[model samples]
Target chain A: MKYWGTLLLLPSLLFAQPEFFGYFESEASTMQLGSTNYNFGFNKFRLDVEARPNDHVQIGANINIQQYWGKTSWDVYDFIPVDHPTGQGLIFTIPDTILLDNFYMKLSFKLADLTVGRQQVSPGVGYAWNPVDIFNSKSLMDPSYEQPGVNALRVDIPLGDRSTVSSIILPKDVLDESTHQFTLKSGIGSFDLTATAAYESEKDWQTPLLGRYDVSERNLIGGSVIGEMLGWGVWVEGAYNTLKIDIPPWSSFLPPDSEETYAEYVVGIDHTFDNSLYMLVEYLHNELGVKKQENLSLNHYIFALEGEVNSLMQDYTFFYAMHPTFDYVTLSAIVFSNLNDTSGVFSPIIDWNVYEDTNLSFQGSLNWGDSDTEFGLQDWGLIMNITSTF
Target chain B: MKLKLLLLSPFLLLIAHAQGPTADQIVDRVTNIMSPENSHSKGSQTIITSSGKERVFEFESWAAEKGKSTLTRYTKPAAIRGQAFLMLNNADDIWSYFPRTKRIRKLASHAKKQKMQGSDFTYEDMGGGDVFQKKFKSRILTEETRDGAPTWKIEMSGIPEEDPPYPKIIMWVRQSDYYPIALDYYNEKDFNTKSLVLSDIQLIEEYPTAMEMVMTDNKERSSTTMRTLEITYAWEPPKGFFSERNLKK
Candidate 1:
């Protein structure tokens, strides 16, 4: 398309000599589940460019190209639709094409800063989970991956030395009233605080047997706090939502009321030792999640699939550790456990800095539990990546 | 008058040579010259591996209260940019800020013995000030010529109860300005484990300063070269700039 041609040539033409940097990564992974196994090989290349033509304006863009080839026992097409090929809101992935991760222009004024275009706008302080991050919901499985961006307009105004107010506007094809977010952040004494509010529109909950049901509009309110205590770093974030949904005429078994309210919260702490050993622990409670298997049904499963809830388990815990064993080698481990089911996934990773800009990493994940419990459906997985940045 | 003045010139030169400073006085002067009351510097460090591979890091440093409080923030190598370290005057605690997580971690005491930023320099090496006089006993070993400059060879041994990183250090202090040109560090086993050389002497703020330095790890066969790009002195940083609250910024 014409846009693709322009995206390819714009970086080179904008500045005679621009600041260019990015990384090339190749990954090979194998997953084992029950009697079936899946193998995947991925090659990814990312290129970033930034140019500041003057003191008042700057432009930046990140282009990503990835090619994946493998065989899987499960159908990947079933999870993603033709209209949403990337399976994420921030990226656009074709069968065998490149994706634009970020492209934005920022203007600096005397009183405020304005940024427009597609860019990531993460505004929460939680390490493992951010309930207030409504713009981009990150995947806990691979937390290191760069988050995708959304097309929007943002404005940031400074209130004082240590406070700021930011607003973002996301526009869809048709003009609507429920696509704005406002956030206020400030530093008080040793703690940093943030409060945010946003509006969300209803969408259909899809199911395999039943067609679709309309969900009601929702309003989200959240806040977060981060500070240091004694020698440890602590953070807490929580979000509350008010929702209204109408049940279908035939579904008389559902609850009579069409209104609901729920909340989610996470508390975390982290520390580092003299031997270059770092540790982090976090606990999360999702009110929308089902507490027990008996409570899980077709209706709740559909809600989970529609991104209304995080997991089937209500209580979850996360632990992470990083130890520098050698001069250029680091060993890391991460675990996510569903406290209710006592099932979890454990991942061990090793990173070696072979050269100044070259790195090699080996990662493995092992899941434990029965078939019906959380993380019990899959067996084990292994991934190795070689990346070089410039 | 001309004959009398010509005769006293040699005597005046001899008097100046004889009045050279003592070892303790020379150490005190070097400490003061190196760590000013309030200073700022921008520098780059290059770590060279045994196989000749190199990695460079750039940083900005600020010190106040004659190096009693200090802060250093990395500015280059995108992966490490925005990372910072703060050292306060009240305690030996060193706080580190990780930009990725937006967290500040306090390093343990034993971390002083570990290598700094994967370089040959240890954390104790960058913790500069009047620590030498407080921890080591100094005495002049001999007078010799180093790099064609007459120098006072000073040998300093750690106090018995101090438990320092190194047992002894041999320094070559230039007699002309009392600046240390080179140092040799010996471990408890009496092995020369590390060595440092200071070069490119220049005058900054009317004080003699070293613009280039190299630290070699004899056991590992590796070295790190540091060069000062810019430096200033006598400008006090803002109050509370070195506190934990500013680490997040």
Candidate 2:
């Protein structure tokens, strides 16, 4: 029966596919952390299909496959105690199978639009959560609580060129073992706001804000002030969240489990010189835990300076990140080839522009500090990303 | 009145000393140097260095008002067809074309020092800005041998402040063939920031052409641009390469 349904869905998709594109890339790397040496290389192939059936309907999906070859050195995070037979190692949960990345149908008419079936809902800049991005590897070391839900709905109303209001909703376990989320956003200029509420059935879903319990429920509200000042551009965003958790024994390591409220804020400023050099600085503060338990607060400060000397020597940037509260520092250099725009950032990374409307990237970080391991959590890893637009 | 005349006398003398060539004279010389009618008879070149290695790309370009201008690549087909170019010497408004997506976008502003495709070459280096349209006050600095060839040093300052990329520039035009042997750019903030050297001038088909051009930046590493193996001034394009519709096709 399932085979027949898949067959029925195939023909219509063939005629409706918007465009087809593919990209292939292979990379090799060797990492030296203290006395340990780890080397590995992988190649990835991706294909994306998008289609707009009519003025009111659209759909798209993506597929990616990758394989790593050779003896993989386990970093501290992946290093398991030799005594424990359950080796501490990296495991592939979502098989190298033909995984369904994203499948959605959207409808639009005059002042309104709706989307259904496995979709992401993102509002505002990348602050609390950017649902629109399904394959986000920017924070891979962190666990995921939900996979954007298997079903979602969206509505939008335009209030002229100056303003807009949008709302989104998705069901959790409506017909499957999926979670649910809903969000609404509205405003113009620097006074924009977004409110989101979510429910997850697999309470054990590892969402940082709601991770203490199994069945996680959360309410999120965020606001931003972004505008140009003087000849400089500046923006600030503040977000608050209320989370409820079904306590698990392990969570008792540091907390009195009850509904908790947390907040995070980010402020950034940038100015460009007439000579084509620009400097930017940003500060971020995330109250990881509830109000009184703000001891779990994470404060990150970043400073970056970029200059464009000429056409051929397009952009040169030096970036520094200091997690004062976490006692970690990250320094990076980014050079974009003005000649071809093939950009490279120091550190291990998978930078790709796979297709016209899609980009996939993965980068790993080496944790530095003076903890027991001296190497800190040297096992920080990003992820395989897949992005497409229709 | 005598005091005013005395003060103005030195200024007049300085003005006379600063005068170089008229706009029409420079335009006429440039036109004669790049004439499409006689391009087929000319051959010339320069050197190029990239990616820590130096290579030579030899080619010829022919431009005719009503006819077609063809630029053929001898060493590297990727450079010409790559996004490092923005050739615009056509009938309509000059168009800047990028080889990456193979599209021609329009050019705006008249900044004298704006870099071309991020290369050391400016928009003027790509041959879009007409020396005739912009006012210049040039001072003949000296006459010297460049790469063993006699060259004339001329400094040009833009009369209009709001011009393209560079506000002031210096150049060395070969006295014998009138080919530019070198160019320098000076901006307000960075002062003398970039320099371009042209050598190996070859008189192919009767026009002096530089077989190599090397540009250096005082800022970052791997910061250099080289244009070599040039077959300047082509007689004409192959039978039917240029068409109004071909611009889009």
Candidate 3:
């Protein structure tokens, strides 16, 4: 009864008018994966709130409400499963699906900042690939889209005008199970430099039989540098990770139990011409990736699905170009290629600034190659989005 | 005698200056008047397309050290609500923070010439410094009067080594105050491409502020207008307020 009363008071928050804003968006999408064709779409409402009740403390939240079309009816077991339970589920029961993307509090001091609760921590310089980040996964289709939040405690200390040292700790059931990272950033003679060290948890599930196959952890040290050279913007990001693996008995070609070190790196450059034409190119090399198409196995696919790695191929390239075709219309094209497999996905996008705070966008992706290839497993996809804000 | 003096006013205004202020001195005064000691400004920019459609963006901007450093944050148009831009050394150093991507991107120094947010203003214009004086040479062309007010017609030629955004700039300076009331911009081919008109002037805190500004594309028939909603020359930023950590926040 008390919780219900508090829920009723949520609407009264509008009385204070503490910088409340957000947007409403509707999207339709269709994709063909392998031989299966799927069509889906949803309407989403995101409400962002920022409040300062005092001088030194600030609080904020990003709440989302979404409903999917052609899927109005859902079974109760989806969200409120009648199986094992947790303390959060026991204390608060939800009758509907509500998502809280960001709920955090920050305290500002003269020299440093302390932040706690669910927040986003993004660290990298690469456009399509970030080798040092483990807090969230990026969508290749929408590389610049928003990131998901993770629960953590972060502290930032400023060294000078353009230098900072940040420490973030993500706790789990026990201290031994937590993930922690320390990052240092500074500017050196027109260049932005970053260095980071982290301890992250990793796991993998084997195919044919859905079972917890290999569970391990990794230690990563990485850095990125961005600067201008010969009138072009250039950057390089790379990470070296050490991990222990367990080889399954059924996997004959797999190596025996051993601890190994691998590196993931990206190099990119961009330039915008005087005529307003923008172009960028990037290359990624993953040492753990499969070198030959014949060596590609189900375990590699599972590794990608489990977020253990971003790509299954050893080498890849990304190219993008954008130009304004009209006063209100902009056109862009992107190509992501797997160099090892000779397969790729080409996407063309268009954005129209319809009116104040309103936008219309259309994006399409076409895959090229055989089914045995990486991107070829997905045939084609298209999405249309209409968004308006207050 | 009073009637004769009043009738000769127009002719006197056309007379050339003898050992008076040069074009460089006039430009120096205008730059100083435009760049205050310290400032915090809140404003809006409205972009009108050739088809008569309009898009508005609201922003809060801060600058210090005679426009050597500047920070601008956009609050309206939800698409870019939490976007912030920081520039130092007249845009020789630039950084952009995107709330959606939770990332900070560094732009090349040469990117100052790119159009800013689909508006007529470039990053160079937003730099809010004496970049023009540092990149070009100015000379007085002729003396004139605008609306019965004494004015100076000045011509600016770009220095090739600086790689200036425009090849030429023509300014109409109001003599009463060191303010460029009107300006015309030329493109690479030295064609008169855009013209800027300034109006709605006011005096606040002993500083001259232009409340309204409009830049029009002569051939495209489109324009972008900026209006100052609130401004203060007394505001001072705390130490490290313009740092990257604050920008990310």
Candidate 4:
């Protein structure tokens, strides 16, 4: 009801002749996880509305609806909302959702641009994985998918002709529970250099206990560089963050409160061959990642599944290749390899642009290696997606 | 006197190498005549396949500093709407903004050679008004009749440092207004691969403007025609209009 009210009031907020457009997408897939054969599909619709009242002010919003179909029942052990208590034999099903994906209002002044809203504020140069971005989790199946926006107020100020300084604040509850980030970006000839610092606090981050959370603190500093050398594009992104975790009472292994420092980095390169084949390769190193397949626990997996972490393995290599078979048809494939577990998965995609406003794509994935390996325990799937824009 | 010698040196050089105006002088004049201080144009490009299918894309563009810096935003074909390209640093740098990603990224220099939106226009053919003569050496070949008018036939070769996509080019310029009418691009094997022809020329604001242009790929048997519906050179953009801030908008 609140989303409907917001939808009803959207037009009034957009004063000018608003530019409205969006897309519809549907995907169906069948896969096997462990001893079970699973089949499911999802449909999504998104509408984007934007208005430029004048040269200095702009407003934009995106509303989305998503639903899944297939086996959707679960038990209490599956998980309960933090606000809702669970009882024995309690069961539930996934519900269709309508959400305000993101919205923003920007005012451009002579000195800077002040934008406040749910905005996409990620800083990284690597294509496969952005180590500096810890708030959003990654999907190995579709690494290039859109990222969920974060609620933030950002101010971008131009330092010089080719440099910028961006300050961002993400408020959670009180003032001390907020996340703040500052980045300085500059261009030196053909290279782009950026340095960033952040102080973050996650209020509802889960501990070992269910339906309970403790405030987690992470302080980070990072830098990245992107350049072209010898006709090939190259980039390096990295971050070093201090982590503090509080031991819950339910934990039997008493390590008390623990404090540590962790680091993550990604190095990447891309090149387009003379024949028009585009290839990209990236390598990631995570200091806190698991070193052996046997050491991977449910907690770490859940953390990776949620937004707390990006990867569960120590080292990973990502490779992508794309080629145009015709003017309207593109064939591409991506491989995600875990070095420590000696496991990998590869997905091949065929995209056909059926005219100007629609596209049909098909993807097939193969999970290879022993079941004890990291990626080998995942699903092998085939999917078809159809998208239409308006 | 040394002052007299110094003042007359330019004329001496012109007379020393002249059958008429040198190739560089003619190209410079044409560049100055075609490019203006500030300009904007709204146009549509129709791409025709060899099998007789057509797709139209609408766009509007603004350029400042005599075509050195430019911004072009697409407004048609729902899939590519709100996509924009920006070129700065005297056309030496390029950036692209995609609305879906909500991010602005810089393009490598070699991206200039690729076709734009699967069309016949390369990034080089769209931008870089002054970089043409800077990257190549041009010489007049002959005087010829083209399109029932007298034209100067010229040849251009790429300089070693630039490593241009096309190593050789043959161009025909109208004698009256120094407007370029036709250009033929040749590959390393001396095969004419693509051709661009300018038609529907008009004098707008005392400048010779090509209101319609057709670029054809000889081997592929396909072409794209660009038509300008509205244009002006008397408009000046707001201060700091070419900055990255405006590019995102």
True contacts kept of 4: 0.23
lDDT tens digits, residues B105-132, model 1?
4554444555667888876787776777
DockQ of all predictions against the true structure, Cα-based: 0.12, 0.03, 0.55, 0.41
- Candidate 3: tens digits of C-alpha lDDT, residues A67-117: 777434322222221222222221222233468877777888888899877
Two-way TM-score contest, 1 vs 4, winner? 4
Better of 1 and 4 by lDDT: 4
lDDT of 3 by residue, B1-249 (tens): 999999998777666454558899998998899899789999999999898888889999989888888898998888889799888887888899988777888988767767778888888877767866878899999989975668899999989898776889999999898788888999888888889888888998988788999988786788999899999999898888777877866
| Model 4 regions more than 4 Å off | A1-14, A34-36, A72-94, A206-215, A247-258, B1-18
Could you tell me how far off, in angstroms, the CA of residue A90 lies in candidate 4 after the best superposition?
Answer: 14
Any idea what lDDT model 1 has? 0.74
Chain A TM-scores, candidates in order: 0.84, 0.61, 0.83, 0.89
**Predicted complex 3: CAPRI docking category:** medium
A249 Cα displacement, candidate 4 (Å) = 3.8
Better of 2 and 3 by DockQ: 3
Q: After superposition, how far is residue A257 of candidate 1 from its true place, in Å?
A: 9.7
Which candidate number has the best DockQ?
Answer: 3
Compose the digit string of candidate 4's lDDT tens values, residues A30-80.
777666776778899999888887888888888889898875554433332
Give the share of true interchain contacts found in each model.
0.03, 0.00, 0.67, 0.23
Q: What is the DockQ of candidate 3?
A: 0.55
State which candidate, 1 or 2, has the greater TM-score: 1
| Candidate 1 residue-wise lDDT, A37-145, digit = tens | 8787789988878777776676767888988777522342222222222343322222444988777777777677788777767667666677776665555666545
Candidate 2 on B164-224: residue-level lDDT in tens? 3456777777766667777787776637767877766677656666565667655422234
